[model samples]
Target: MPSLATRHEGHVLVIEMQRPLLKNALSRALQHELVSAWQELEGNDDLWIAVLHGVGGVFSVGHDVPELARGEGDEADPEPVTGLFPLELSRPVIAAVEGPCYGLGFELALACDLRIAAEGARFGFPDQHLFTSHKVASVLLPHMASLGIGLDLLFTGKTLDARRAEEVRLVNKIVPEGQALAEGVAAARDMAQRFGSAEAFQKQAIWGFPGLPLSTALNLARRM
Candidate 1:
């Protein structure tokens, strides 16, 4: 079976991570598949929203540590595999997480525009212990969660469960185990149909013009 699977369910494009044996870790093959899948979805007009999740019990337990440990794949910059999705995609992504989202795995969820987790889902960042730093988490965590919480997660290497994540507003919602993908896809479909392309366009405009001042941003918003 393909390590990653993509299918269109009406306006929603569901991307499922299918490496159940390894806790859905990001293998080299899976990484390439995700980039290709997302690129195809971005080019297709039939799809408006993408919902990302994993098969088996976990969303992702992060990188394939054994693979990395064995030096089995091409290595370049230490940036996480999630960086494969360039910031220019011009599409909104929602992540449905279960089990453990650790290291780069949690960063992938953070990269999404919205994240929904199953009850008891776990999140953590342990780059320091790995003798490397998480560039994405270091740069983007403060923007998503409180500075204190972000620091604690990044620096202390503690895991946060769904309830703690919800209390901190890190996850949009939490559902029963095995229901995160369904709930997340439902939310994505609703947002896509109800808001249409205007919301997507607006998000692109804002990210595309981040250097603009407040007055300039307002002017751009008016034009949109």
Candidate 2:
């Protein structure tokens, strides 16, 4: 079966990561599949938004270290793990996370415009090791939560449970365990019905964040 799967519910496209037995690890093949899915979400005008989750009650444990080491099938080239999606997708995504969201999994969640994490879910940055890079997390975490928390999590490889994640605004909200998908899809469907391309337009302004000058950011929002 494909590592990643996609389906549509009205204008909301749902992307599911399959690999429960392996804790939905992000192997090289799976990473490519995610990029493809994001591209589809971007190019398909009918797809307004996306909800990303994993099977078997877990978002993702992390990257498949062994696969990353040996490389996958032949030529053996590994790209820097730049999170799961493009730098900026025109369409927004929602991460419905449960269980352990670590390493690449945490990056995937952070990449989403909003995140819905199930109760008991765990979040962690990858250990500070030669094989892993947390560039995406390093950039986003400080802004998402706090600079001190980001430094602590990244440097110490500490993990946070869903309550703490929500408190820090790492996750948009926390739902009952096993309800992340249902809640996330329902929320997406509601937003899809109420909003249109305006969501993506607003995202451009939000993504600019602390970098873009206030006047410039205002112009972008106004233009959108």
Candidate 3:
């Protein structure tokens, strides 16, 4: 079976990680499949939003440990632009996290526009135990929360439960266990119907303005 599967509900595309036995560990093939799915979502005019989740009650445990053990690594240098380092898709994407979201998985969720985490969900960078650096999370987490909190997670390699994740504003919403996917899809549908094209521009501004100087950001906002 494919490592990733995708289906569409009206304008909301649902992308699921299919490697349940591995707790949805992201192998190189799965990463490529995710990128392809995002590319398809971006190219389809009918699809205005997306929900990314994992099957079998797990979002993802992170990169494939076996692959890393074999020295295959996550992916080659200069990773694909689509899913690596948060590509600028015209439409927004939401992450529905159920179980453990660690390492690369945490980075993936952080790349999404919003996150809906289940009660049983946990977030962390366990790979830090191996002294490995997470390229995306290192940069994204601080922006999502305070620098102190982000560094705490990174340096300690500890986890945050669903409530803590929400407290820190890492997740937009929290639902009962097994309801994250449904809630995420419903939220995506609501946004698709209400946001229209303006949401894309708004998202662009949200992502772009953070890195700009105050005067430049204000000028850009004025133009928007």
Candidate 4:
């Protein structure tokens, strides 16, 4: 079966991680496919938004440990694999999570502009107890949550369901199980209607300009 699948609907593209047997683990091939697919979407003027998800019961089981353990991942240099970083996307992307979204899976979702999870979905940085982790929660989770909250989850490696994630503002919405992707697509469609062809440029400005001061942002906004 294909490791990943992509379909375009209206102005939105949906990419599904399709390895149910591994619970959709982020294998090297899958990562390569994701990067290529996202790059295609980034280059397309007709695509306003993209929604990412996993098939079957889980969003992902994180990186393929067996592959990494066997030295099979696409590690070309000291930098993290290109597939693991979606920060280069020039357009808005949304993550529709269900079942378990853990470790690098959680980080991938965090990379998106919006995350909409299923009511039955689970989320966590469970790799803190594992030796192979990159310790993203130590740095990124605190920025996303209260310092106390970050410590609670990170130190314990505890998982939370959809409602808890929403309460913590980790996800934008929680819908019925089996409906996360649909809900996410609906949200993306709504955003597409609101932004039209300028959606990518707008996302680039908002996410790309936050590091700049107010005057810098004003100048950037004027250019936009």
* The best candidate in terms of lDDT: 3
Which lDDT tens digits does candidate 2 get at residues 1-224?
79889998889899999998888988777888898898888888888888999998889977776676787553143443444654587777899998999887888788788999999899996455735667788888988899998988888888999999999989998899999999999999988877766354456556776667789878877877
Ranked by TM-score, top first? 3, 2, 1, 4
Can you tell me which runs of candidate 3 are displaced by over 4 Å? 71-82, 198-201
Write down the RMSD of all candidates, one decimal each: 2.4, 2.3, 2.2, 2.7
The TM-score that candidate 1 achieves is: 0.89
- Superposed by TM-score, candidate 2 places the C-alpha of residue 219 at a distance from the truth, in angstroms, of 4.2
Candidate with the larger lDDT of 2 and 3: 3
Worst 10 residues of 3 by lDDT: 72-81
Give per-model TM-scores: 0.89, 0.90, 0.92, 0.87
lDDT of model 4, residue 175: 85
Give the clashing residue pairs of candidate 4, or none.
Answer: none
Best by TM-score: 3
Which tens-of-lDDT digit does each residue in 1-224 have in candidate 3?
69999999988999999999999988778888888898888788888888999999999988776766674434542242345434387778899999999888888999898999999999998765445567777777888887988999988889999999999989999999999999999999888888765255377667897768999989988998
Give lDDT: candidate 3, residue 201. 39
Which stretches of model 4 miss by more than 4 angstroms?
72-80, 133-139, 198-201, 209-224
- What are the per-residue Cα lDDT tens digits for candidate 4 across 1-224? 56999999898999999999898878777878888888878888898789999999699978776666676335422224565556567678889998999877887887788889998888886766455544555555666666777777767888888888888888888889999899999998888888777354476667766447889889888998
Global lDDT of each candidate: 0.80, 0.82, 0.84, 0.79
Worst 10 residues of 4 by lDDT: 72-81
Regarding TM-score, does 1 or 4 come out ahead?
1
Question: Clashes in each model (backbone N, CA, C under 3 Å)?
Answer: 0, 0, 0, 0
Q: Cα lDDT for residue 162, model 4?
A: 88
